[model samples]
Target: MAWFILIFSGAVEAVWAAALDKSAGFTRLWPSLIFLVACAISMGGLAWAMRSIPVGTAYA
Candidate 1:
């Protein structure tokens, strides 16, 4: 479960990057919203995984 969460976090980070790029300096509403939401989910998953996994490993 920790591994899954960690991986999910990583995937969300990637998606978030793409969404941020598409946000057009946050002037675009939908993509900006997606970026913010994805950022929250990614950080939440990272924190959840930290309960079982070390920061370095979870980050990697």
Candidate 2:
């Protein structure tokens, strides 16, 4: 379950990065919103997983 969460978080990070690039300095409202939401969810999941595992180990 933890591994799944970690992987999902990583996927979200990738999506957020791509969306941010598409946003182009916030010129695109939809992509900007997507990036913000994805990043928030990814960070929240990462924080939850980090509580039980060391940051290095969790990332690895």
Top-TM-score structure, candidate number? 1
Across residues 1-60, which tens digit of lDDT does each residue of candidate 1 receive?
999988888999999999999999999999999999999999999999999998888877
The lDDT values for all models are 0.94, 0.91
How much RMSD separates candidate 2 from the native structure?
A: 1.1
Poorest stretch of ten by lDDT in candidate 1: 51-60
Instruction: For candidate 2, give the lDDT of residue 16.
Output: 99
Q: List runs of model 2 lying over 4 Å from the truth.
A: none
User: What stretches of model 1 exceed 4 Å from their correct place?
Assistant: none
Q: What is the Cα-based TM-score of model 1?
A: 0.94
Give me the overall lDDT of model 2: 0.91
